[model samples]
Structures are given as structure tokens and as C-alpha cells.
Target: MTYFVYILETMNNKTLKYNLLVKQFKNNIYTYSLYMLRNRMDADDATQEVLIRIWNNIDKFNYSAAKSYIMRITHNLCIDFLRKRNLLINRELEITEDIEESFGDESTESNPYLVMQMKIATQKIKEAIEKLPENLKSVFVLYEMQGMKYIEISKALEIPINNVKVNLFRARKKLQEELKIYESE
Candidate 1:
């Protein structure tokens, strides 16, 4: 009878621990997975896999450094998935600025022509971002589009914060130069 009680208590503790970890890591896992996979279906699969891995191996995770550990797992899983699927479309520049223009906030309401120009500008920006190196591209995508912080990106990539800043700086500069060329045309 004492053994049975011990087993139940142990199981309950594990369940509680898992629930807490899930709550803490869920959003970061989902967002990072989605950012890397770039497709809803693949991201969904990756999210499920990440959650399962984290849950089953939560004991191995250090509470003091939990976020970095989870992000590393997510990053590695994404890379593996990309490698296995051969799905990293290198510099494809597939996003159209017009798509973003259509969903613009109130600034474009006064002038349809201005909105068109803005769309063209945005499209050029998208193309330039697509043209960035893989490392720079990932940083830009995570920080700018996905709204992740420099610290999170640094942790996920295992790169220095200075490197993240430099890459992001270069990405913005290159994109602005590209947009300038578009405007001059």
C-alpha cells in the first residue's frame, strides 16, 4: 500500500511539472517552429514534435536555463526537418508587396496611388530580405516579421547579441538600398 501511494505521488509530480513547462514554453516553441518551417502544415508538425520531446525529456532540462535549451531543440529540429525535406527555398523572393499593401493600416486610406507605390516599395523590401544570406535572413525574419527580441534570436542561434545586431543592421541597410533602386526606377 505504501508503494502504491509513492507511485501515485511521483506520477502526480511529473504531471504537474510537465504542465508547468508546457505553459512556460508553448508560445516560444510555436513561434520559433513556425518561423523556421515557413509553412503552416510543417510548423504544426514541428510544434507537436517539439512539445512531445520537451514533455518526455523535461527532467533533462535545467530550470535555470530553460528557454535557451528549448529554443536550441527547436532550432535543431527545424534544421533537420529542412534538410530532410530539402525545402529551404534559397532566396526565392516569393512574397509580393501588393499582398501587404492590401492589408495596410490607416495611412494609405487617403491616397490609392500612394498605396500602390507603397505596395511596390514593400515588395522590393521583401525581395531584398529574401536575397540576404541564410543567417542574416533568419535573424531578420525572427526579429522583424515575427517580433522576436535580439536576446531570443541570439539564444536560438547560439550566436552573440552583437552578431545578431550586425546581421540585422546589414539586412536593413541592404533592404533600404534595394528599395532606393526600386524608387529610382
Candidate 2:
């Protein structure tokens, strides 16, 4: 059963609207938090906190760039959570490079050995990213992985465009240097 208010929009209507918004951005928030926090629990908590922030600030949402606005809120919430959690990996992430995880029991669809090798390479990439400082990591995550433009990142992070560009440049250089070991293998 559904209830409707006589007013233009009811409380239920507001709930539905926010629910839709959450559905649209939930995955993005979780993924960003996961990469930043490197822990499922913290990522989940950050996503919930960000969603709560969105709910509380629904009226303040900028209709023009709602996606960016929501993402900005998410980014802020995630960074805050990370800072509170000692700004370091409190829990070790159990990244699996197992052959079975890459290839199922049947293993007929793909080569298990190649899949395992790829998983190892992927783990190394994650390790390199994790080595980045918080500032560079945030910028790298937004520009490289999240695909935000420099201006958008600047707005979201409340930093200048030039700073965003500089951080991204430094981050890329650091990553290149850190991952150079793989090239020799």
C-alpha cells in the first residue's frame, strides 16, 4: 500500500528521490572508498556516511552538476573517514592472486596459469598505488581511475586546477618509478 499527501511532494516522495540518487552513485562511492581505504568495512562505512550526508543536504544539491556534487560529497566523506582511521591501512587487505579465483573449477574457458599471472600483476599495481601519499593518492584516484577532469577534481576537492594538475603529474611520475621493478622481471 502507498500513501500520497495532498501537498506537491510528500515525505515518501522525498525518500524515493533520495533513494534513486543513492542507487545511481552507491557503486561509485563504494569503489572510491574501497580504493582509498583498502578495507571493505571502512569502505562500506564511508559509503553509508556519504549517503547520509546526501540525504541531509538534499535541498542544497546543485541540479546542474548533480553527479559531480554527489561525487564531491562522497570524496569528502571518504577522505575524512580515512583521516580518522589513522590515515594508514589499519587492516591488511587480503588481495588474492590465486589461480582458482581467476579461473573456476572447470578452468576450460581460460588458461589458469595466464590468469594467475595477470592477477599477480594486478596485485603489484595495487601495491604501487597504495604506496602513494594521501594527497597524491586522492588526486590519482580521481583523475586516473575515476576519470574526472582537472577542473572537476579541483572543484570537488576545493583545490585549484593547477594544483590538481601538479598533483596528478607528481602522482604519475611516482607510480612510474614505483612500478619500474615489474619491467625488469
Candidate 3:
């Protein structure tokens, strides 16, 4: 009877920890997947698979490195998904509608011109990000958009720290050049 109670307690504690970890990283996983996969449906599927993998491997990984571990899984899953579907060519840019809707407030709604300009600017930036090469895009998304540190990006992408720095630098330079062209137009 005592052993049964101990088992129950252990299971409950593990479940609680798993829930917290999932909540903390779910959005990051989905966003990374979305940027990598370039499709909402595929991203959703990838996110679900990541969550399941996390739960399955909960006992195997250290909680201290959970972020990198989860992100590594997400990155690999997205890559596999892309490869399986042969989706490298003709990739369409998926500008998130959430960004546009988030700009809607009492003040912004009052100025239709401002709203339109904001959406256009947001669209252009998203398009620029989408146009980046895969290496640059992954580094950009993980480091800049996902707010991950250099070490974290290195771990997640399985790249050297120096490579992470170089890729991020190149991503920023390319984005700047792309956006500059848009500004000129």
C-alpha cells in the first residue's frame, strides 16, 4: 500500500513538471516550426509531434537543458517534415495574421492609413524573413525571433557557436539589404 502511494506521488510530480515545460515551450516550438516548415498546417502537426516526443522522453533528458533539448527536437522534426514532402522548392511565404490583428487597437483603428501601412510593413518584413536561405533563416528565427542566446541556438541547431554567430550576422545583413530594397520602392 505504501509503495502504491509512492508511485502515485511520483507520477503526479512528473506530470506537473511535464505540463509546465510544455506550456513554457509550446509557442516557441510552434513559431519555430511555422518559420521552418512555412505552412501553418505542417507547423501544427510538427508542434504536436514535438509535444508527444517531449512527453515520451521526459525521463531521459535533464530539466536544466529542457529548452535546447525541446528546440533540437523541433528543428529536427521540421527538417524531416520538409524533406519527406520535398517542400524545398516553390516555398510560399506565410505572413502571420496574428501580427496584423495585434496592431488593431482603439488608437490604430481610428487611423485607417496607419493600420494599412503597418500591415504592409509587417508583411514586407515577414516576406524578407521567408526569403532568407534555410541556414540563415533557421539561425535568424532561433536567435532573433525566438529570443534564444548564442549557446542555445548552437545546441538547438547542432552547430558550432562560431557558426551560430556567423549565420546570425549574415541573416541580419541579408534582411537589411532586402528591407532596404523595399524601402527604396
Candidate 1 per-residue lDDT over residues 98-165, each given as its tens digit: 36645577454678677767676666666666566567767887788757788878987899999999
- Between candidates 1 and 3, which one is better according to TM-score? 3
RMSD of each: 8.0, 5.9, 5.6
| RMSD (CA, angstroms), candidate 1 | 8.0
Q: Which candidate's TM-score is highest?
A: 3
TM-score of each: 0.61, 0.78, 0.86
lDDT by residue (1-185, candidate 2, tens digit) is: 12221221344466776876777678878877777787777888888888888889877665446557767887777778877877566456544433336445535667868766776777777777867877788889878887888887888778899998899999999998889976776
lDDT string, candidate 3, 6-112, tens digits = 44335647687678778889999998988888888899999999999998987776665677888999999998998999988858766566666667674444788
Q: List the residue pairs that clash in candidate 2.
A: none
RMSD of 2: 5.9
Ranking by lDDT: 3, 2, 1
lDDT of each: 0.71, 0.74, 0.84
Residues forming the 10-long window of minimal summed lDDT in candidate 3: 1-10
Residue 124 displacement (Å), model 1:
9.6
Where is model 3 more than 4 Å wrong at Cα?
1-12, 104-110
Best by lDDT: 3
